[model samples]
Target: MARGDGLVAARHLVHYGYKPSVYYPKQGKNELYERLKTQLTNLNVPFVPDFTEALKSADLLVDAIFGFSFQKPLREPFPSIISQMEETRLPVLSVDAPSSWDIQEGPPKEGPGAKFMPGALISLTAPKPCVKWYRGQHFVGGRFLTRSIADKYNIDVPDYPGVDQFIEVGVDADEKL
Candidate 1:
C-alpha cells in the first residue's frame, strides 16, 4: 500500500471512531515513511504481517497499493495480493485510481486488474483519465488546490459546499455519501 495515503486514511478512520489495522509486508526506509508508520503505531493501529489473516476479519479494504505511476506486468507479491482481494469480493476503496490501472486506458482489458473492481474510489487533487471506467462511488479530495492552479490547468473545481473536504462527483449534491 502507499504508505503516505495509508497513514492519512488511518488517521481519518481513527478520527471517525474506527479501529483500523494495517498489513504492510515491506517497510520503507525513508524518514517520512518511518514517521508515518510510527504515528500509526502510536495510534494503536496493528501492523499485520499476514494478508490472508487480515482479510478474514477486515470489514473493508483501502487499496492504496499502487497509484498513477504504476505501470505493471503483474510483479511479485502484488499479483497474489490483488488476486486475493479479487477472490474475497469485499468492498474495496481504492486511493487515486485502482492499482494496476493505466491512467489513460482505464482498467486493463485482461489480467488480474481486469478481474478486480473497487466498490469506491477517492481521487486525490482531481480525477484521472482512468475514472471513465470506474463504475462506483467516486469522490474528489485535496480541497487545497488554489483557484489560480485550477485556472492554469483549465480544471473545473467543484463548488464544494461549506467546509467539506471531499465532494462526490457524478452524483447530485443532495445524494452525497
Candidate 2:
C-alpha cells in the first residue's frame, strides 16, 4: 500500500471507532518495512509482523500489503501468509485489490483455486480496472470508498512538478505547490 493511503485508512478507521492494526513482513532487512512501521506508529496504530498469532488476534484483518504498485506475483511469506488467512475464515478487509490478483484483469484464477477475497475492499483513489471484470463472488458486497491522502488528510505530496516549477518560474514550488 502507498504510505499515504495506509496512514489515511488507519486514521479513518480509528476515527470511525475501530481499532485497526497494520501488518507487514518484518523478516529480513527491509528498509521499506521499517519506514512503514514508523508511519503506522505515527498514526498510533498497531503494527505486527505477518504471523498466525497476529492474524488470530484481530477481529478483522485489513490486507494492505499489496496495493496499486504490485505488478508481479506476490512472493514467499506473504503468499503463504495469505493462504493461511484463507484457511482461518477470518473476516478480511483489503485496502485495494486482494494480494496475487491483478488489479487490471481480475484474479489470476477462479473457483477453488481462487484466493481469498476480503469481506470488503476499500478502494483508494479510484476503482481499480479489475473490479468490473471480476465476478461478484470474488468481491461479494466488498467495496468501500476512499480519497487520496492529499484530499483526505490535506497534505502536500511532493513530486517532479516541484522541479519543473523551479526551472520555469525560478522559485521552489515545493513550498507553495
Choose the strongest candidate by TM-score. Answer: 1
**Model 2 TM-score on a 0 to 1 scale:** 0.60
Give the whole-model CA lDDT for all candidates, comma-separated.
0.80, 0.55
Model 1 lDDT per residue over 9-123, tens place: 9878988999998877667697987898888888898888889889989999998877676776878777878788778767898898888788788777887788778888988
Identify the runs in model 2 with alpha carbons over 4 angstroms from their true place.
1-4, 26-36, 42-44, 110-113, 133-177
lDDT of 2 by residue, 11-100 (tens): 668778888876546333557655655766787887665468776677766666666666665677656776775676777666557666
* Cα shift from native, residue 30, model 2 (Å): 11
Please give the lDDT score at residue 64 for candidate 2: 66
The number of residue pairs in model 1 that clash at the backbone is: 0
Task: For model 2, state the Cα shift of residue 102 in Å.
Answer: 0.6
Residue 42's lDDT in candidate 1: 88
